[model samples]
Target: MNGTMPRSSLATTADVAVRRTVGSVTTPAPTTTPLRLPGVMDAEGRVDESRLRMHIFKNGGVSPTERGLVWRFLFGMYPCSSTALERPLLQEQLAVRYQVMKRKWQQMLPDSIRLRLNGTDAELVEAVRYFDQRQAHAQQQDQQEEVRDKLAFLELQAQVLFERVTFDLEELQEAIRIIDKDVPRTDRDLDYYLGEGSGNLLVLRNILITYAAFHPEVSYAQGMNDLCSRFLEVMDSEVDTFWSFSCYMEKFSKDFTADGLHRKIELEAALLKELDPQLYAHLVTDNMESFTFCHRWLLLGFQREFEHSDALRLFEILSCDHLELISQQVERARYQERLASKHSIVPEDNLLTEPQAINTDFTFELFICATILLENRESLLRCRNDVQLIQFTSSLQGTLDLNFTLKKAEEHFYNYCKRSAWDYMNGHCRTRKNKDEHFLYQLRSFFS
Candidate 1:
């Protein structure tokens, strides 16, 4: 609604060439031309990010073979603007950084423990030989009293080491413990994570622990294992997976915090109220206002709602935020137009404005959530309490129609924009901080 062309208006001739009708509503025909190998890369081997993102959104997702390289761009492992010549250097730098951080946590353990966990057979054998030789020497010297004193000193050394361990280190160790327990259970049904000895599982544990070590602020959380495992599956390299996961967390890390999560819930609730007042009212009456069931959905990006492959597709699509990017571009264009008009200047046709940060407040993910609710409006309406609502949502796991849901969500977004424009033109829009007042302002300005 920020002066952007409505979805219907933005549709191209090709989009309209094939139409689909659903229950009296006709929409653009779905088309897919996912970017493949050379298509994603320019002559210089730099990514065409805008094109890649659009392809993912329009085509649903890239093919399984291309997902890894495509995700590298999407998650910031390779910057869209970086050339092939620059990428290898960048990869080396990142790999070094990953190892440095990995070692930082690894070195925190006592030598024996560290060697046992990360050492090779030769190193472990050398450690054993060193200890045995020292014990033999002590026995041959017949220094019974000295040996007893040495044992006491060793015990005291351990006690001091324990006492000297930083609070942060203890916290990290606890996070590692939890991550160890969770890694085995993550995506276990998949062949990649099928066994206790799965190398993929080890990689998953390392990334999570390293993430925890570096990001003490939002150290390992319960659901992070699910998130990390997905990245590991796509990006087989340990360093690439860690960095890509870290980049992803930059945007979504807030989702793991209390206030950030509460704000999202409020926004979701506001959206539902705007989209369907009756449904919101019914939920309020049933003391389901918290929308707690949505926690997992938002936290894991609805990873559990669909099968593994579909969830990957959904994550990449959501990460694209294609609609939101379009909205931002529209807003920027309007701003440029206003300046041109004020200064009596002619705007250049090819001038580009600086990129704007994405507004997370009104992301397309919320629309997807709204679409799911409206799709099941009748069933949700019948539920009178939170438990029933939770059960109903839980039962929806792995049963969603991804294509249908995406199409419907897109429709909802277009409709919302149209409604916002209409409300602004009619002078009925009001601004309130918690209730999309800023968005209404943008709408009014866009129309003005």
Candidate 2:
């Protein structure tokens, strides 16, 4: 999708009108490497004017396009209007920049997403101001094609140099061991790490804190520290670590949502029932009809289900987008259909909420989680006692066949999608609006 809108200069996909959400502000495909900062503003008051500079510093650097937005907004080429403009703390030029920033972000997204970002009854200025710099630091750089080519070249050159050097695997391995072991897992309870991008552990903590507001219930789960650490361990840069983790969370969202987790468990159980009804019956015989223990597995993402090192490896592989489970999930759609039955589901004008469907992309996280469990299903089936079950899942640590698992999941996803209809996940982009519209319609009963 081109960032530039045609005709009226504004995207008309119903994403306008407070529809564009912060969460939907996704990093497009790989592009040039300009500069990127870790996460946005810290607990301290360190942001200066000129969004260009702020984003460049925050994200470590900016992509040409993002940089263009930064500069355009800052200089006043783009006006945010009341809808986009958060406030008028600065002169028109600066105020417009803030406006353009929120307006651009709010564009092409659902109104419900915007509401979630602003919450209820908060002034537009206050909300816009918050978003203006929230990602000022985390802004990922997706420069033009030429820049990307050059950056790729340099990376290749660096890779060659790395190969030429006498690298120490054992030493690096030792470092990983020590770092993974030493980092305090308790950082989950902390709101933010004042230390800032000091290392993988701290970087992980920072991302968690930054997103805590977006996902309040998930807050800071223990295993997330491990996930962040592994991402940094592989990505090397804190920015990359956060981006990768954020991407990972896209799929793993169900595990974190309150009350929804039970739905996840039910879906997982349903899939298992479909695939192996015999096993479902077996579990039911054991008083495991509720699928409780598996909650931690889905929630922490196998951190408790497997060894630390193994969990790290599995997550890293899943994060790489190289698994089949990513495509082959029926549970999400099944669950969405279930949600509709509760009457909480709504129909929206223009949007496709009349009958909700799961987005195929939503399957990505479920695929990873499913792949992890499906790979160990053979062993999982044999276990009788809870300890043995945990032990058996834990045993599936490092032996996961990454490629095979992803391929299988993809095969399942593609096939299932063909059998199903509509994009399940993306369809509900304006979920809040759907709910609101439905509620308001209900209120008209007073007139009746």
Quick one: best TM-score, which candidate?
A: 1
Considering every candidate listed, which one attains the maximal lDDT? 1
Question: After best superposition, candidate 1 residue 62: deviation in angstroms?
Answer: 1.0
What's each prediction's TM-score?
Answer: 0.69, 0.38
Count clashing residue pairs per candidate: 0, 34
Q: Report the Cα lDDT for candidate 1.
A: 0.65
Q: Identify the runs in model 2 with alpha carbons over 4 angstroms from their true place.
A: 1-183, 186-199, 210-218, 239-254, 300-378, 410-448
lDDT by residue (tens digit), candidate 2, 141-235:
34466544543443343234223222133332333333333344433322232233222233343345433322333434445666565545543
**Would you list the clashing residue pairs of candidate 1?**
none
**The 10-residue segment with the lowest total lDDT in model 2:** 11-20
